[model samples]
Target: MRIVVVGGGMAGTIFANNLARRLSSELKAGKARITMLSASDKHIYQPGWLYVALGRMTPDELEREEASLLEPEIAFFVDPVQSFRLGESHVVTRSGKVHEYDLLVIATGSRPVPEDVPGLKENSVHCYSAEDALKLHDRLQAFTGGRILVTVGLPHKCPMIPLEITFTMHDFIRDRGLIDKTEFYYTYPIGRAHSLENVATWASGEFAKLGVRQETFFNLKEVDGAKGCVRSEEGSEVKYDLLVAVPPHRGEAVIEENKLGPNGWIPTDRYSLHMQGDHGEKVIVLGDTTNLPISKAGSTAHFEAEVAAENAAAMVKTGRAARSYDGKVFCFIEAGKDRATYAMFTYQKPPEPRAPNAAMHAFKMAYNQLYWASVRGLM
Candidate 1:
């Protein structure tokens, strides 16, 4: 049996490593094979970007060679897929090579589309990518004082980032002794401060204590950079000296070009993690590539990858799937520089975040270093 995994982000890497371990006996007997193909040779810890924006971590600290984290039994390639020929059970790469597989796992992640909003790309600084984080770091460093605005768009990766960034930046500015001189303004697209009700409630109280102004139902429409103000789709306008935005997101372009799902997201079974169509049995979708209504956090990808890997390995060895994904996700929320909290929930339950503590913050910091081990399937 041949299993091909696409995209080397957290989801793909974890799935490949887990499956290789499960099929070790079959691999030694020449009965099964696991191969991973990715666009880049470097695997980055994406969550660390928030810390990068705050000057807590350097970009080099978050990077590792993709092959270094994989098991020796798994084959690795740096060729990116250009087109998906699911009808023929094959994929064409940018190098004009065709690869066939018995089981295909698509974990291609999402992309931030800041340009989707008029003038937002030109005026905002975001930490979605390494370069963007570095740019934000520089901008924050040079900032003296004034209003700092945080604007959020819907369906972004790491649902807690909008709140996390705001809280961390408040601490950052306070450390610089500019907290009093700077006014903090935040906007969300929903009726509340966050998509999750409990998180929103927690964030609202925290904002009140910090004296941060907030506006809800403020969908992004346009930014007038010259006037230093942003307009909302609902005809609301807000001014800012520095704009920090969590832009809207979409799945990879290959998925969109292949028409796998609208906006590059593949229609996937929420429970089985399989593609939702005739060939669904042979095609599994994980991570940001799946059109599941869940938080697009690294933990979401981590849990889904576990289920996909287990089911695929079971099918290869015993001719049947073994388990189903339960929509489990765990995320650490940095309430401030020295304190943190966490949210753990499943499909049937909502997250109940506890009060912030230094111990949880320390654990979150430790987990940052342990992420490499986690990706290698050693956790």
Candidate 2:
């Protein structure tokens, strides 16, 4: 049997690695093969990039070669996927190479769609992608002090990241003695400060203490780069000196063209991570590309990979039913002045039901080290 895993992000890498390790015996027997496809040769630790933008971490610390993370035995395809033919049991690469597989796992992840909003692509600086974060970091370093606007475009990855950016900027400016000159504004389309009501209340309080203005329920409509202004769908306008925006997210076109999810995301059972397609039995999906109600964050991807690996291994062994994936997510919310908070939750259950404290911050820091160690097999 041959398994093809697409988009080697956190979820894909972990799932592929886990499956390969568990099926090593089968692999050695020439009974199974595993392949990993990635668009880039480098594997980026996305969560660390956020800290890199804030100057707390360096870019080099967040990136690792794709080969370093994968098992040496798994086949690696460094090319963009052009399309997926579910019925044909094959995937066509951008170079026109077709790969046949008995089982396929889609962890293609999500991309920032700045063009989804009018004028955003041409006007704003998006900080979600690694490239965007680097650009934003340069811009932030040159900025003296002005009305800085941080806004969430819509349906972004790591939902609380923008808020962390805002808080971190506040601390950065305050440390520079430019607090009075810097006017920080945070805007979101969500009705509340954060997604969860309990967390929103705590976040609003944090913003208040940090003297950051909050704007909620304001959908970003267009950006006026020349005037440094952002317009909302309700016709309200927000003027800023520097705009840090999170772009709308969408799944890869191949997944969309195949009628995966309503919004280009792959629809899957919350528990099983099985992609609902014509060849549903042979296809599974996880991470930001899925239509799961959970927050689109790295932790969710990591957690989902655990289940996907078990299910894939089971399918190869006894042909047993796949286990369901419970929605689990953990997030670190930056408070101001070297302080931070963290939260963890599951489906329909709120994250800790409150704001995180210093202990949570310590946990957050430890988690980063622990995660990297796990990836390196040192943990």
TM-scores, all candidates, are 0.99, 0.94
Model 2: residues with Cα > 4 Å off, grouped in runs: 257-259, 353-355, 376-379
Q: Which digits, one per residue and each the tens of the lDDT, describe model 1 over residues 1-379?
A: 9888999999999999999999999998999988889999999999999999999999999999999999999999999999888888988888998889899999999999999899999999999999999999999999999999999876799998999999999999999999999999999998999887888998999999999999999999999999999999999999999999999999999899888999888999999999999788889999999999998999999999998989988898788999889999999999996899999999998888898999999999999999999999888
Residue-wise lDDT of candidate 2 within 174-288, one digit each (tens)? 8778888888898888788888777788888978887889899888888888887999987789998888888888987777776777667988878878877578888888899
Clashing pairs for predicted structure model 2, backbone only? 271-324, 271-325, 272-324
Q: Could you tell me the lDDT of residue 171 within candidate 2?
A: 75
- Candidate 2, after superposition: displacement of residue 335 in Å? 2.0
Error of 2 at 375 (Å): 3.6
Please, what is the whole-model Cα lDDT of each candidate in the order they appear?
0.94, 0.81
